[model samples]
Target: MTITRGRFGHYKLLKNTKRLSPHVPDIHVYSESVLTSLLNNLQPLFIRPLLGPELIRIIKSGETYNLVVNDNEPIVTDRKSIVPCLIKQLHPKKTYIIQVNPTISYTPCRTFYTLQRKREGANWKTVHKTVQDTECTPRYMNFLIHWKLNRFLLAVAGKLGDAFVGCHTMVLEIGYAEGAFFLYDTILHERNSKWSQYQSFIRSRTIRPFMPHTDLCTKSTLKAFLRNYGKAIIKPAVGQQGKGIVKITIMPSGDFEVQKRNNLSTYKTFDALFQSIHSLHLSREDYIIQYYIALGIVDGCPFDVRVITQFDEEYGWIATGKLVKVAAPGYFITNRAQKLLAVEEVLSVPDSHIEQVCINGSIALSAQLNNLSIIGFDIGVEEGGKVWVIEANHVPSIAMFHNFGNNEMHTKITQFIGKRRRSLSENRKEEG
Candidate 1:
């Protein structure tokens, strides 16, 4: 493998790598024609500088493009004027490239991280670093270990080190999108502290069996799902707090009933139902169509279990906490729970079984991704006592444990995070 100098060089190297070629998104040097063509083809595309971390996103909507710059509000621009808007927003005399955004049904809540490793005597050890992203600023927070992905990354790092023998360290920007991993940029001769967020899709091949049937929402997909299951849950691909979730059920009269929160609307035909959902939710952001699980109900309200699992190098995966969140009155989403109870009280499944399933799912994710230390599993227990993983939260809320009277698990999570922080500090001292 050859050491790639700039973004283009990195792309070329990644393209040539046998293991990484298929994951690479279509990219091109910036030109007005290229931009026009990409805007025509890809829904949301990235335009980034060749050398810096600054980025621009152009998303197509109706007849205009929503031009966004790095987490900012999108400014609407027409097709002919998008290049000029980029010129005004970007710095002069810098080269930029356009990349197709590769995310489909990305998780709503996720933490950003950077992985760093040092090579010595044919072995590589991670230089543990933790970065906490805040509302206004992004800084290094944590080091997560994905055993298999780590090995592959380190192999690439070793090749880079061999190619640039004199260069001590290089920072590579790797991303996961649509199930495969891609290396998009590399910073050499210096440490690039720029923060890049990577999206982790839980529907990786290994973890799919434990999850319910899920697919990106489209007319055909939604129709197929509804046809097969007679019901579907349409949720934002990137959302939290149980927001923007709509349930559509096929009535006995062959009508579609769309329910959002407390309100319900009826449509006569599948096309009418699809059109209503598309305008109300799908057109704004990405959404997924899922087979609606009829969760076990407590006093007529459906409830789901939240199981917290953490990874430990010494003892393997640990299931730290379990609690049942019953949906509020008139609302099916459990985020606004009317009551929380112990898991064993509500469901027939054994505690041991739920713990094993959650831990196994966590491990399976780690095999495919450089995943987080902690993952939260939203599990639905059916009336028949079957368990289905509804969703996996990468940044699962920890404070909720206290509300469920699980102080022991909350403290354990706090200690676990503190230990990681201390390890990160020790690694930094050694590097210094």
Candidate 2:
């Protein structure tokens, strides 16, 4: 994660373009002739396709060759078909070039981070450190897999200046990105987004609830929703760790109740409820009101299922992991301090069907999103085995998985991400 150019004495998320390190080579530019020249200059570069296994390489160390998607295929590339072939097939963004031998299975390089808790303050900090996997700790484009814990210090002591210069990954810190929350909510807008796309995917009896919306929490807006649903959730437009969420429950007689973490209030009028909310330092403009999902309960508290997904061009979307989260007593959110269960332990739906529902939700969500390939989804199940999506998160915390002792899911996640990254890297082509 990024550790520089911060704001507000904290590592705030800023909208910035990612640039390659000034010390690295300028090899991001891609084109047919440019790629060929790069191959000649770098020697032994290969062109690939979006689908199927094929390698376009120089033949017999000669400049002349046929460009095809598969190594065994004999289709010849005409002059006009070279670049157009690429443009028509591969994804514009997911594609990247790797210098390693394409024949050997190589995993995409990834960075890992942990939420370092603050000792004195009531805050969590995203710290950049080392991560270990089955194979290696990815340092940007290189692997620290075999390196010792003090490898950097050892390299510095040996005066190997280039040792640490080109080995680190450039990761955008995700935990603090409030702008992404607002963006996801905005994309849930009916006009431009795939809210309907999700509908198209899961137009089944199990799709049990209305689509969620994000709106300003004005008195009129709140009252209008209360009049219709009698219950709704209020939360900040951009928040994390489930903080500042209030559930409003109104009876037919207009008696209203507001509940939050460890606190509850009963108000005689809507204005009084709004005033009570304002007294807690929350403003209508800063928050959004949405339908309060009637989540299935575990023990005595409400809970939701967290499904983690990875995307691929061939397979669409795949669920890597899922967890049943039980909210702490008196709270409506299953944030960091919550308990978790296996999906089969609570969800009445068949395990396979529940997984398929999660997969469909992830695919629809990824269709609307641009940057994230790994997404965390919060889903709720009702009494009739119907599932409703609560939220989609780009920077989802894996703390719950770790806390629940579901380490196998974490391994599945690591493997899926590595494979997905490699797939995204291979399918580099111009947008058609």
Candidate 3:
């Protein structure tokens, strides 16, 4: 793709590809007067109810009225009587508009609109929102179908790109929450890469094999993971709000215990722990068991840092935001459901290292993800200065940051989008 800048905007021009030829219709020009004459000639009796009173008056008064046609003919016999005719003439390969809601509608081929509903009293109002050509329709059924089909086609195209262009990239998520993997895969495919890029990168770094819940039957792999890290956390692969997480730790005296929400606790031995994991009966496909990283504590509470990476028009791979999440008292997770703390309050170590670790982690993650334009990295530093990655989330929650009254994250995101828009406008100019 060749990106060019001009007065209009940034536009991409395909190189070395045959330009599509325009196909002219046999009847190319239908004069407005001719169309009006045709409508005028229609019988009033046949058209009256069809056009509706408001539309009929407009047509009689020589005002513009919309028309709807099928097979080159108006569908309603009484054209004048029809309500303001929103005439959409269909051609062999012409685009059409389908209104899904008051606020949002979509053109047949170009865009999809996603609309949100706001409830006021007993009525609902729709809010039209446009997302980068990807979300153009408000119909859930159509949206899902489009997404699946697009993903499949993108995957095939990505394979072709890999073979020809060899432009491969990795995807990393720091917080693997429910929607995290979905967004990661979405971005990967959108950028013409395979979801395997994410999985492969993660698996290659860990010494022991990490198994999704589905592979839990493999006792050897499970034991290896537990022994290597001395503890393991079993969590739902597609969970949010820090729900359904069990931290399994083996004490120095050889006793084992499982920690969960609401202070629920279970004591177990090695055999018992294995049984407990099996008894949960969670779909192995939807869960993951990983070695737990004992992140350093602040005031005896564990905390982690979240780093957001975004592409900069001037400086690439800039760290957009950083914040510390402190776990609630007697809890292992630092989600909102847990407690949140400031960076200074969380890290027991020197303050200088906090920024340094965050900067280093952000850079490393950005490179690992093949210089992905956007990502959120969660980093944990142990008491002994061992930094471990908990996970990588592509669309980490910015709600918490916003709630905390921090505008830095919002500003960075806005700047990133603005730069892209300006780049797009520039490219359009060169194309013209």
Candidate 4:
């Protein structure tokens, strides 16, 4: 095969083609089988055993002639040596060679925030900070193969969902799903959906709206809402990350009190609060006023519980993880701005009671979200054990489970995808 180089200065060799180049390197030995063998042999040498005899044999064999594997792809050993060799063997006008590198970086790609603890001789010292920067470049072809294999595995697992759903009792999920998963969980009653329908369903079945927060917009409506709950929270309905949330309380002396997150002081009247809120440019429709739940404190910081629901192959609707999110100092919402602590560590009240409340609240929330499929229910409990529904998140972040060393949630997700793939495949097979 003798061909001119492309604009990128690279020439690709077709199948079973012999190079007839005089003063250029022949680039035709890069095959998928060869790349797979190279990756399989190279990956296991990180611990103890180094390269095996077979790899050594492959390396020594001059059959590879002037080809060298860097990272994993085959490249011309030396442009001078290989070019001269090819030129002498087969005469060609010119040649172009493509280079590939494959190496996994030991460091993470993104700047991840982590807490570090140190011990001075024996006791622990204050946490310090660190930064890590490393680039990992995996062999492109091999990476694609691994990714496809994982996808295939997920497809196979998803087909077995029916069996799993029949056997499992509870399902906990913490991820985003568009519509299919929601339909499946709701129709099958397999997992909590985390949608408003769950709340409506629970309210219809139980005859009580769970944590019905007042919707006060006007001054008169705000006064009425305040009179009902004594303490109310003004929040944006479509808001997130705890922004635009204000806590309001009515003083016994007939004056109004207001507190804003991250603020050091409280306001005594609506005028003072409205001035602050107005400065934020909040529109009437951009905010919602609700009864505030005095979530119990953990280490002097208020915290809330997040109960995740998912559908498993063996279990229908299961509570996967119970996480206690403690708000940051002077913050109102228990989000990433807050510290993630174990439920046991953050539960300030009695263990038995807290557990019961969490279980009951989770079950109720799950049953409500069941109509939706994947859901995260945030529940707040007061010091006196008054439990209230904070909110429901349809698309909650799953990164927390990655921090906790439990990837079962990911497995379930893969399984869900697999089942859907299998179902589609079967339908196509039937149609065909």
The per-model lDDT (C-alpha) reads 0.67, 0.50, 0.42, 0.42
- Which of the numbered candidates is closest to the native, going by highest TM-score? 1
Report the lDDT of model 3 for residue 213: 22
What TM-score would every model get versus the actual structure? 0.57, 0.49, 0.46, 0.44
Candidate 2 lDDT over residue span 169-223, tens digit each: 1112111111110000001112112222333233334333434643345455677
Candidate 4: regions farther than 4 A off = 1-202, 206-212, 251-257, 264-268, 271-284, 312-314, 348-371, 405-432
Off by over 4 Å in 3: 1-217, 237-240, 251-255, 267-269, 281-286, 337-339, 344-371, 421-432
Please give me the total number of clashing residue pairs in predicted model 1: 7
Query: What are the per-residue Cα lDDT tens digits for candidate 4 across 1-432?
Result: 232222111112211122211111223233334333443332211100011100111121233332422122334343235434333322143322221221222311211111111111122111111111122222233555445433422322222222232211111111111211100010111222222223333344342334655432334445567767887777654555666677777778766666667664456776565555444423322344566777788777888887665544455545555677888887766774456766667565554543444345444554433333445667787887666667666566656755654666556654654764676688899999
Q: By summed lDDT, which 10 consecutive residues of candidate 1 come out lowest?
A: 191-200
When 2 and 3 are scored with lDDT, the better candidate is 2
Estimate candidate 3's RMSD in Å. 20.2
- Please give the distance, in angstroms, between residue 142's alpha carbon in candidate 1 and its true position after superposition: 50
- The candidate 3 region of ten consecutive residues with least summed lDDT is 20-29
